[model samples]
Target: MPKGKKKTESRGAGLEEYLEGTVFLDLWRDKMFLGQEFLTWLYLTSEKNNHFFELPGGDGVEAFFENRLTLSHGRGNNRRSVAITTTEEPRDPDWDEAYTAIGNNKRVIKGTLRVKAENREWRLTLPHDTLSPQGVKLSAVKDPAETDDLGKAGKFLDKIALTAELVSIVDELFSLFLSRRLSETWLTEDVPRLKEYLSSRT
Candidate 1:
């Protein structure tokens, strides 16, 4: 093989093993709800020279949920949106150095990974966010008015339901990311496991 091809194959093999290991699967199993949590970890480590929660303030996880009834009645956007932000403070100065080097070089990274739900189907999303010098923001956008509600009460109830779901998913995903075991192959293998875990709780 050519030198470049040989290097590529070697790295690919190592990543493959990394994916199959228990460490990866366990992490996937934990953060099954917040879909992009694992990607956040990988991005920070590789590009930012940081560990999960490595920033001075550590990681911050936030979820936002809106309900239509509250908005329609209260006079506002009448739409619901959920957003989560996770921030990591670097404990080691070395991490800061690495991040500075990568950012200055402006490297582009691309890959695919799968996240499995409790229903035996994998949920896949483009696991990327626009990176700013400050931190990362994860957002889910959906129109709240699209929900079928007969009246104000119904709309209120719907909002509550949506918020509850968002909270639950955020909690699970945040916990998983903090544990630091998420890897590409493990997420692919644990779709069914995650589904089972979520189903049991619900």
Candidate 2:
């Protein structure tokens, strides 16, 4: 057998064996609601303060729900989900329907967010169950094809830096949410304000 093919098969077999263990999957299932709460908190918080967030590390970013939003209620056989989408650019999408759905006890299940940090922007689809960023569109950078080899490497590094920055931003933001969510004031302060925001919207 070819060396490369043998290595690939070994890696695949290892991965399959690893996935056969259910410990992490069980933990994820148990704690999946945290992701849902984070997304819900993001929407509530963004509705105030013009969708801008100041990270715990003192970095400022603006994030807005755009393009699509999904909300859900119940689980298992009783689960129901709805998605809201917009195609227009520049003009903000109206979220009255989503607000109403929330008022009816639905939680945010997924959303497309446009986030701006410094002068650059990124768009991603975030799902509540996993908190993974999907369909990510990063800000435009220098094209490698238009540059010399050295310049191409520099541009490639620039892209890598942007990706790392985005991951940091997401981690920090989620950490902030977890802090607030797990705090003593969440029920007394945040929940009341969140309720008020929904009440006003509906």
Q: Which candidate comes out best when scored by TM-score?
A: 2
lDDT of 1 by residue, 67-141 (tens): 100100111264232232223332232333323322333221212222222221121223323111111122224
lDDT of 2 by residue, 1-202 (tens): 0011123554456665676766887878887878877887888788766888988877788887886889888877898988977777853534788888888888888998888887778889989877778888887554557544557777778767666677667777788898888899989998999999888877
> What are the lDDT figures for the candidates, one per model?
0.33, 0.78
Error of 1 at 54 (Å): 23
In the order shown, the candidates' Cα RMSDs to the true structure are 21.4, 8.6
In model 1, which regions exceed 4 Å deviation? 1-39, 42-149, 181-202
- Residue pairs in clash, model 2: none
Weakest 10 consecutive residues of candidate 1 by summed lDDT: 66-75
Report the CA-based lDDT of candidate 2 relative to the real structure: 0.78
Q: Per-candidate TM vs. native?
A: 0.24, 0.80
Report the error of model 2 at residue 118, Å: 0.8
Model 2 CA deviation exceeding 4 Å by range: 1-22, 91-94, 140-155
